[model samples]
Target: MDDTCAGEKSHLFCGFFLNFSLFGTGVVYTLTSATSMRAIQRANCYHRDGHDAPCSVGGDAYYMFLFGLAQAVLLQIPGFHEMAGLSVFAAVMSFFYSFVGVGLGVAKVIANGVIMGSIGGIPMVSTTQKVWRVSQAVGDILFAYPFSLVLLEIELINTHEMRFDQMKDTLKSTPPENKTMKTATRASLVITAFFYLCCGCLGYAAFGDGTPGNLLTGFGFYEPYWLIDLANLCIVLHLLGGYQVYTQPVFGFADRHFAGDAASVEVPVPMLGKRRVSVFRLCFRTAYVAATTALAVWFPYFNQVIGLLGAFTFWPLAIYFPVEMYLTRNKVMPWSKQWVAIHGFSLVCLLISAFASIGSAVGVFGSETS
Candidate 1:
């Protein structure tokens, strides 16, 4: 907003919400994804005959820890910018994993009588630890869609130093850019929801009740070891892409705040003149990645971390930011019908998040039977 709205209460409040939620979200994002990488890698070990590695708080996590550290170092290469072009490979791998998971899942259902917990693939709440597990489950499921799409919207595709720049120097496009962005965002959201629902349905059906955090671990067919190994390899590739997608933004943000223009970091490459890696580049991003990897190894609870993270940020980031930013940017009166409706929706999101937060706390402190 170029400090135009700095003195205004609404604008300041929006900035606070955005920054606070984004910081929390970044940590959770890194840890959760790194944990996923660890889980899949460990699951791959299960493909070995009589050699099953446990998935949580184990040695494989250290391997992912090294992977994250290596990513930070390799990201310094100028070619790292071309990583976005590798999305085709990521997409292919994602589709391959999805098809494999679903195909095997269907065969499993046919053999196992479509064994599911309850509610169309949603699990039933058991009596033991019902309060804690059910509440945590509710929070996790609620965090799955709608507003969560805002994370992709707000952060993806070179967000111009993580702020909207009015299609000026940063975006540098005609008015149609706005329309294109909106259309793309909506389409992406719909596609994502559909795919997520399908994956959940298939995964839940494959293993029935009490599925593990990583679905690949639950498979019994170790005879096709190569296929299992390939599937887990795809998971690694997919997570590596995601690591770039998320960590680069963090690097860009910190680099800009510290060094004005991050691209100006001089690299010792003849093909690129006046580009050299600054000391800040050497130290900051490396430290950030190392810290997150360490935390991922420390608290390997994938779903719990995500649930608690969602509980804390979902209200302010997703619901509050969009509504508040809309009113502030578009100059909608706060008391108008649209404003009231938006705030009311935000209120509902806040209530849901509050319950989720409580549930996550209960899960952490109480004895979880399920």
Candidate 2:
């Protein structure tokens, strides 16, 4: 691979899709906590009226989008990378919420008698619908292990991982065949999958068909409102940190592309009396955040957004580019069995993800038009 090809282009595409995934993940987390608080309030209302109980938990997810727009202001801060250290604490907060969510779901099942409460309660959908949702679901779930691959790319320039010369050599320092990377990657994925399944089982058992997009909210903070408040607080903090990690690369990419070098290696802004700020940096990030926030405010269908983003973004980022890059790097033939099977499978996934996104877009928008 040409040095600069892997350098700028790979990072650009990686940042784009990686940020897409991160932004979506941020919305979900921010929404998760906010939705739980709403659910808690609704649960209180339901307690007074016997007929309103079932409807209490399925609150519309739109308000969360509005909140998302408000939070985007944080992305506009000048020293975003400085706050990146908070990600560690944010991660810890995430662990707490995940555990608490599972616990609440389990308790709900035991106390209220599972919602439809069984494996059988999982609704059967048409094959086409299943294909769309399944593809979307898998794409959303990429937050699990595959998300780490994007993060791992940072190790290349990270001085903590290597001395000076090693930092300069990306392929050697972080080879795809590295055993430690392979093990960590596989283990994190399995653990994440198991964690999600456990949480899903509990939530599904408690709410069944009415399970909220956020499993945490499905617990409905009736008895222990404190838990709902606490968990949501954690989510907010986590999202603050997450938004930066995903967008910092994007911010850097734009700054460099426009300024002709890294932000630190100052280049003069044109037509500004030698003002040094990368003004494109400001407009670019602000618009990106605004656009995402607007999308959130408009549709705000959490599951549907997941499906659409996965289908639209993941097929290219997660499936096609990586496979094509590998083949081109290794001089592998399209006719080779390994190439044929892997690339072919990628194509199939891309199709399914695309169709799923389209189907979801129609469903979301069609409802409004009608």
Q: Cα RMSDs of all predictions?
A: 5.9, 6.9
Candidate 1 TM-score, C-alpha based: 0.74
Q: Give the poorly placed runs of model 1, Cα more than 4 Å off.
A: 1-58, 78-83, 120-128, 146-175, 220-223, 260-275, 329-338, 364-370
Model 1, 1-370: lDDT tens digits are 2244344675666555544444444445555455445545554566543455553446546565666765675567533345544554666677786677666667767877856666644334666456556667666765565354344433344443223455345645434545656766677678667766766776676665665555554454443556665776676676566555545645666676785544445455444455568677777767876776766556555567667666766676567656655777789886889888888888988888888888876665453443
List TM-scores for all candidates, in order: 0.74, 0.71
Q: Write the per-residue lDDT of candidate 2 for residues 114-232, one digit (tens) a residue.
A: 35555544455677655555555654554333543344433332423455446577665543435655565566567667778877777777777777767655444455655766776
Against the hidden true structure, what lDDT does model 1 obtain? Answer: 0.60
How far residue 359's Cα lies from its native spot in candidate 2, in Å, is 3.0
Whole-model lDDT, model 2: 0.60
Instruction: Highest TM-score: give the candidate number.
Output: 1
Residue 200's lDDT in candidate 2: 73
